[model samples]
Target chain A: MVEPVTIAVDVMGGDLGPDVVLDGALQALRADSALHLALVGPADVVEPFAAAHDRTRAVAATEVIAMGEHPAAAVRAKKDSSIVVGCRLVKEGQAQGFFSAGSTGACLAAATLVVGRVKGVKRPALGQVLPAYARPCLLIDVGANADCKPEYLVQFAQMGVVYMESIMGVSAPRVGLLNIGSEDTKGDEFAQKAHQLLAASVPQFAGNCEGGNLMAGDFDVVVCDGFTGNVCLKTIEGTAKTLFKYVKDALMASLPSKLGALLVKGDLSRLKGKLSPETYGGTPLLGVKGAVIVGHGSSNATAVANGIAVAATTVRANVAGVIADTVARAGSATPGGEGEAAASDAR
Target chain B: MVEPVTIAVDVMGGDLGPDVVLDGALQALRADSALHLALVGPADVVEPFAAAHDRTRAVAATEVIAMGEHPAAAVRAKKDSSIVVGCRLVKEGQAQGFFSAGSTGACLAAATLVVGRVKGVKRPALGQVLPAYARPCLLIDVGANADCKPEYLVQFAQMGVVYMESIMGVSAPRVGLLNIGSEDTKGDEFAQKAHQLLAASVPQFAGNCEGGNLMAGDFDVVVCDGFTGNVCLKTIEGTAKTLFKYVKDALMASLPSKLGALLVKGDLSRLKGKLSPETYGGTPLLGVKGAVIVGHGSSNATAVANGIAVAATTVRANVAGVIADTVARAGSATPGGEGEAAASDAR
Candidate 1:
C-alpha cells in the first residue's frame, strides 16, 4: 500500500449530520486502511461518535458549517466552520483533499476563493463522471458556472480529456460538444463558436454529439456550458426517476409482474448500481489548487466512502498540477499567458 | 369511435420518402376506421407502396418533397410539394388536418408562412409531450423560435395549458417555467421575467420545475423561451440515452447479469415503453391555423403511424381554433383587436 492520504470531512453537512458523517468516515477508513481524515465540525458534535469507536490518531477535527446560511457569506464569515476549515487544511497542505456533503454553492465558492483557481484556468468546471459502457464518460460543468464563453468550453474539453486520460486511464478520449442536433449548423452563437474553437483548438474533436448520442455512450467525454450541462444532468436524473417509478407501478399493476420483480430483484439492484450517481461517488471541482470532492446531497456511506476514495485517487493522479500545466499550454499563445490572467477578462 | 378525424398526410416529405410513410399510413388507417387521409407525395414514387398494400380509398396523392434540399427553398420552389400540397388540402378544407414525418424546420416554416399562425398567438410554438410517470408532460417551444422575449414564454404557457386541458383533457394543468432552480432568482433575464409574468398572468402557476422535474411527473406542462427550451429538450434526449446505455451495459456485463436480464426482460421493455419518445411519436406544431404534425426524421412505421394518429387527434380536438379563440379573448382586452394583431406584430 502507498502512503495514507488524509481527507477533511464536513461532519455537520447534510440532513443526517455528525452521526452519519462520522459513521461514514470511519467506515471509509476501515474499507481503505490507507485513508485518513480530518473530521471538521463542533468538537461536541463529533466527540460522541469518535469516542464510540477506538479514537485513532488517524482522525482529526475542526468546526461545523451551518446549513441555513448563505454559502458565499458563511464560508467567509465562519472560517472555522467544518467545511471551510476542512478546505483550509487542504489549502495549507495539511490534508491531501477535502470532501463535503454540504451546500454545493458554498463548496464551489470556498474551493475557488480559498483553494484558488489554477493558472490559465478560465473556469473551475464541476465534472460528473457517469456510468458509460465499459468505462465512464465525464460530463463537465454540471452546475458550476452558468454562463461560459467558447474559450472556457474549449478549456473544459481539454481539462476533461486530461482528467479522463490521467485519472480514468482512458487514452485519447473522444470529446463531444452537447447540442440539439448532431449537424454542424445547429445551436446558438455560443455553441456554434465553441464548436469552431474546439474543432480548431482542441486535438480530439468527436464531431458533435446530439442529446440522444450522449446516453448512447458514443463518446468518452461530453462537454458543454454549465447551464446546458446542469440541465442535461438533471434531465437524466429526472428521466431515470420517472422510468424507475413507471417500472415500480408496472410491477405492482399485475401479479405476473410482481413475480418477475421478485425473481429479478438482485438484477434490479445491480442495474440500479449502473444508474446510481453514488456508484461514481463524488465530482471533482477541476482547475482548483487543491483536491475537492463534491458528493450528492443524499449521499450515503458507500458513496461517502467512494468520495474519499476518489479524492485519494485524484491526489495520487496529481490532477490539479496536470490541469494547471494543460491550461498553461493551451493559453500560452493568448494575451497574459495562463497565470494572473483574470478568467472573466479572457472571455 | 370519436367521429373519425380526417387528416391530410404529406407522405413524401420525410427522409425515407413514401415507403416507410406508406407503411405507417396504412397501419394507422387500418387501426382507425374513422380516419380519412389525403396522401401527398410523388405520384410515381408513391404508386409502388400504394400498389404493394391493399389500397385504402381514403388515400389521395400530391407530388414529391425531397429530403436533402433546403426546407423553405424546396417548399417555395416546389409549390406542389407533398408538404405544401397536404397543408393546402387542410387550408381548402379538403382534409381537416396535415401531418408530415419530414423536415421539422420546413414544417414549422410551412405552418407559419403557408397555413399561418393562429389569431392573437404571439408566436407559433411546438408542443412535444415528454414521457412522465403520471402521463406525459407537454414542453412548449422545443425548437420553434430560437430567440424569444419573456412574453413569448408567457403565451406559450397559457396556450400549452389550454392545449392540454382542452385536447389531452387535463384539468387545471400545472404550468411550470423551465428554470435552473426552484428559487425565483435562478435563471437568465428571460426566465426571471417569465417567472414573475407567469405568477400574475397564469391562474395555475406551479412555480418552477428544474430540468430534472421535466419528466418526474411534477408538472403537466413546462414553458420556456425557444432557445433555452430547445437546449433543455435536447439535454433531456441526450441524458436519457446515456442512462439507457449504462443500463444496457450493466445487463450485458457478464453471464450472471445476462441471466438477470433474461429474467427481467419483460419489465425492462415495459420501462423502455414508458420513457421512449417513439411512444409519443410525432410533435405537433401548436399555433398553426390548421393542424400540422412533425415526426422525427428517423421515425419508422410506429412513429409515422403515431404521427398520423396525432394529426387525427389534433384536428378532432380543434387545437388551433381553441387557441385562436383564446388568443382573441386575451388580445381584445388591451388592443384595437383586429384579430391576431399582437401575434402578427410579435412575429
Candidate 2:
C-alpha cells in the first residue's frame, strides 16, 4: 500500500471562520481513507477536534494574521500565525502540502518565505484553472509578480506546462502568450520581448492569444504578467455575475419569463456548477518548494474540501521536485545560465 | 436653430465595407435634418451615395488601410487612404469630427498624428462607455498608450471626467484607479503611484477599484494603463459571450428547457441588447484636438449610424476644448510644472 499523504490545513484562514474549515477538513478526511490532516490554529480551536478525529493532529498557532495586514511584514512578524505554522509544517516535512483560504497575499508571502522556492525557480506564481467554455485553461502568474520581466513569463509558461501535463493529463500542452492583440508584436515592450523568448524557448508555443480568446480553449495554457492576468480573471468573474443578475431581473419582469426560469432553473444550475470556482478548489502556488494552495477568501466548506484534495493530488504528483529538475536542466541548456542569473535577482 | 453639424465617415472601413457605412450615413441624415455627412472613400463607392442623398457629399480617397497593416506605417504611407483623409477633414476644419468602424490602431494613430493631440496633453486615450448593469461607466485608455506612467493615468482621468460630464451628463463623476486590490497600496509600483496621484488630483476619487467592482456602477469613471484596460474590456466581452453561449446550450439540452428558452427568448434578447457593445455606438479617442470615434470592426449599419451620432454629439459638447482647458489648468497648478515635464517624455 502507498504511504498516506499528510496536508496542513489552516483553520483560521477564511471569511467563514474555523468552524467551516474544520467541517470541510473532516469531510475531506472521510472522503480519503489514506489522507492525514495537520490542523493548524489556536490551541483551543484545534486540540479537541484533533483528539476526536483519527489520522489527525493539532498544531497550536498563537497568532492570527488579519486579511488587511501587509503581507511580507505580517508573515515576518506573525511567526506563530496559522499560515506561518502551516508553511513550517511543510518545511519540516511534517506535512506534504498546505492549504489556506486566508489573505492571498499573506499565503503567497508565507509560502515563498517559509516553505522556500524550488531550486533555480525565479519566482513562484499562482496558477489557476479558468472554467473556459470548451475546456478548462490554466492561467499562470494570476497575481504573483505584477511587475514581471520577459524571462519570468517564460518560466511561468514552463511551470504551467509541467502542472497541466502532470495533474491535468494534458500532453504537449499548447501555450499562448496573453497580449492585447494576436500579432506577435501586439503588446508593450515586455510582451514583445516575452513573445520572442516564448517562441524560442517553449516548444508548444502558440501565437499571441487576445483577451477575447482566453476562454475559447484555443490554448491549454496562457502566460501573462500577474497584473493583466489578475484583471482578466476578475473581469471574467464580474461579467458572469453581472450577466446572470441581469437575466434574473429580466425574467422576473414578465409572467412567461418567470415560468420559463422555473423550467430551466435546474439546467442552468448544472451549468453554473460546471463554471463555479468551488470545483477548482484553489490556485496552486507553482515553483514553491512544497505544494501550497490559495483558496478564495469567500470559499465555502465544499471549496475548502476540494482544496485539501488538490493539495494531496499535488503532493502525489511530486510537482515541486519535477519543476526543480526541469528548471535546472533548462538553465544548463542555455549558453550562459541565464535562468540562474535571473533567479538571483528574484524577490 | 443650432448650426448643422458635419461628421466625416470612413465609408471604406469595417468588415462590411462601404455599403453599410453609406447606408448608416444616409440613415443618420434622415434621422436628423441638421446633420450632414462627408462620406470618405473611393470615388466609385461614395460618389453615387452622396449624389442620391441630401446633406451628404463624397470625398474621394485613392487608398484604403487594411486591418492587419501596421497602424502607424499605414497611416503615414497611405496618406490618401480613407482613414487618413477622414482625419485630414477634421484637421483642415472641413468636418467637426471623424468616425470609423475600422482598425482601432489606425484610427488612434491617424487621430494623433493628423488631427493631433490637444496642447499640453501627453497622450490621447480611447474612452469606451461600458454597459454596466446599474449604469454606464467610462473606461479610459482602453487601447491607446499601452505603456503608461502615473501622470498619463491622471490625464486619462481628467479627460474621462470631461467626457462623462459633457456627454453623459454626470455631475462630479466618481473616478477610480483600477488595480488588482481595493487597498490603497495594493498593486505594483505603477498602480500604487497612480492611486496616490488619482486620489490627490481627482476631486471625486473613489479609491482603488478592483476588477469585480468594474460594472457595479459604484464608480462613473475607471482609469487604467492601456494594456490592462484593453485586456479587461475584451475579457468582459469574452465572458459575456461565453456565458450566454453556455446558457443557450444548457437550455437546449432537455425538451422542457428548450420550451423554457423559447418562452424567455424575448426577455433574454432584451437583456443581451442592454449589455451589447453595439448599443454604446463607439469609443471616443479622448484628448485629441478634434473628435474621433472608433467603432467596432464588426459594426452593422445601425451601429455605424450610432457612431456618427456620437461623434456629432461629442463635437457639440466641445469635449476637445473642455479637455484641453482642464488638462492645461491641472498642468499649471502642479508645482514646478511636473505635468509639462512628463508630457515632454511622452511618445
Candidate 3:
C-alpha cells in the first residue's frame, strides 16, 4: 500500500497559462492512484476542474505574479497569488509539497518565506539535475545564494548527498566542487577556502571538477555558489541550442543531407526527449522545510505533470527530514565551530 | 609590397612534438612570402629545418618546460627554455611576435614577466574567440587572472575593443559583462562593481550578458573575471563534446539512422571544421607589450600555421600599442581617479 501524497499545483504559473497546467494535473492524477492535487489558481480557473476530478480540489488564489515583476516585492505584495497560496498550503499542512512553473524568483521567495527552512539548514539551495551523458549530475545552488560562505556550501553538499541517495537512488553520491581546475590551490580565495571545507566535510568529496566535466557524468553531485552554477546551467542550455542549430543547418545544406535528416529525424527527436527538462520533471528546492519543486516557466503539460510526480516522490522520500538530519550531522562534524556548528548547536 | 613580419615559434612546445610545429612553420613560410620564422627549441629539433627553409632561422634553447611543471616556477627556473627564449626574441626586437602551443600558464608567465606589460595596463588578460552562431565572440580573461578588480575588467573590455576592431574587423565592437543575469543589480559584489565600471568606461557597453548568450553571437566581446571566464570556456567545450556524442549515438542506433549518418558525414565534417579551434588559430595574450599567440596544446600542423598567421596579423595591427592608448583614454574619462587613472597619470 502506497502512502498518499498531496501536492499544491500552481496552475496560474507557467508561460502556457492555466490550461496546460490543468491538463497536466489531470495527467498526474490519472498516473498516480495515491496522488492528490490542490489546483491553485483564480477561483474560476480551477474550480471546475477540482469539481470534476476525483482526488483533487480547488485552492482559490486571486492574484497572479507575472514573470517580469520583482520576485521578493511581488511575492510580498501578491498575498493571494498562486505561488504564495501554493506555499501556504504546504505550510498549513494541507499539502505535503508545492509545485510551480512560475517566475523562479517569486517561487523561491514565497517558498522560503511562507514554507520556511529546514532546521539546521543555513540556506535553502536550488539543486538541479543536468541532463548529462551516460547519467545526469545534480548541480546545487543553481540560483539561490549569489555570495556563499564555505559553511553554506557544506550544508548544500549534505543536502545534495541526501537528495541524491533518497530521490535519485544512488548508493553514495560522489560530490565535486565546481572550479576552474581540479587542484585545491587553482582558484580565487573563495574557491580555495570552499575546497578546504568541502574536503573536510564531505566524505564522498571527489576533489574539484571543472566546467567541462559537468555534463560528462563523472560525478553525481557538483556544488558551487549560485552565481557560478547559474552561469554554468545557462551556458549548457545555450550551447545545446547553438549546437543543435548548427546540426540543423548542416542537415539542410544539401539534397543528400536533407534525405539523411528526414531518415534520422525520429531518432533525434527521441534523443531530445531524453535530454529535455520535461523528462526530469523539475528542480528540487533543497534545505526547505517542505517539498518544493520549481519547474521551468516554459514548461508544457507533460512537464507540469512530471513536476507533480517529482514533488510527490520527494514528499514520500522525506527529503526535507533527511536534509535536516544530514545538515545537523555535518554541522556538528565541522571544524573550528563556525556558523554551521552554531546552527547545529541551536538545533 | 606587404611589410615583412618575423614571429618566433616555440618548436618543442606542443604535445604533438617538434615535427608538427616544423611542418607548420614550413607551411606558413610557403603561404606568406613576407613572413619569417625564428624556430626556438633544442638544436637538433629546429636547426636542420631552419637551415633548409628560406626566411627561417633556428634560435636554440637547451631546456624544455613540460606541460605538468608549475608555470611561474618553470619560467623562473629554466632560463634557456623554449618559451623563455621565444619571449626573449620578441623582447630584443629580433621578432615582432611570439607563437607557442606550450603550457598556457608558462606562456602567460613568460609573456608577462619577460615580454612585459603595455603601459597603463594593470594586468595582461588572455582573450579567446568563442566559435558562436553566424560569427564568433571574443571572451577576455579566459584563464589569466583568477581574481580581478573592477578596473581590470574595464581594461579587458578596452583591450577587447581594439582586438575586435583591428583583427576581427568588427567596427565599434559591442562589449558585454559576462554575468548571471542581464539586470544591472544582479550578481555578487564583484559583478555589480564591474558592471558600473564597464558601463562608465566603455561607450560600446551592451550591459550584462548571461552565460546563455555567450555562443549566441549577440555580443562581439564578453568580459569577466578570469575564474568565471575559464569555467565558461571549458563548460562550452564540454557541452559541445557531450551533445555531439549524443548526436553520434542517435545516428548509430538503427539502420535508417546509420544510412542518414553516412549521407551527412561529409557535410557534418565540414561543419565541424568551421567550428574547430583551428579556425581561430590561437588566443592572443592581450595587454602584453608584444604580440603573443598561445595555440592549443593539442594543436596540429594546420593549427600551428593559423596561429602564426594570427600573430603576424597582431604584430601588423600593433594591438599592444592601441590597447595602451585605449586604456589611457578610458582612465582619463573615468569618473574617479582609481588605479587605472593612476596608471594613466604615471604614463
lDDT by residue for model 3 (A156-263), tens: 888888888988888888999988887778776667777888888789898898998999999999998888889889999999889888999999999999999998
Please give the lDDT score at residue B76 for candidate 1: 84
Q: Model 1, residue A243: what's the lDDT? A: 66
Worst 10 residues of 1 chain A by lDDT: A338-347
DockQ in order: 0.36, 0.56, 0.55
Best DockQ among the predictions, by candidate number:
2
Span of 10 residues, lowest total lDDT, candidate 1 chain B: B338-347
Please give the CA lDDT of all the candidate structures: 0.74, 0.87, 0.88
lDDT of 2 at A305: 97
Model 1 misplacement above 4 A: A1-4, A31-34, A47-69, A334-347, B1-5, B13-20, B27-34, B45-70, B231-271, B298-302, B331-347
Estimate, for each residue in B1-347, the C-alpha lDDT of model 3 and write its tens digit: 86799999999878999999988888888889999999999898888888888999999999999988889999999999999999999999999999999999999999999999998888899999999998889999899998666678888998998999999999979999988888888877668878888887789998999998999999999998888888899999899889889999999999999999999987888888887777898999999977999999989999999999989999999998899898887777875525533221110
Candidate 2 Cα outliers beyond 4 Å, as residue runs: A1-3, A334-347, B335-347
TM-score of 3: 0.97
lDDT, candidate 2, residue B191? Answer: 84
Model 2: CAPRI class: medium
Q: Per-residue lDDT for A1-347 in model 1, tens only? A: 67678788787776655677666787788877777777777777666665664422223345455555667887888777777777788889888788888878789888988888888787899999976555678999887877566677878888898888877888899999887667776766557766877887778887787766666667888898776677777887787777667666765665666665665556667887767888886888998877898888777777788887788888878888888888777776543233342232211
Q: What share of the true interface contacts does candidate 1 keep?
A: 0.45
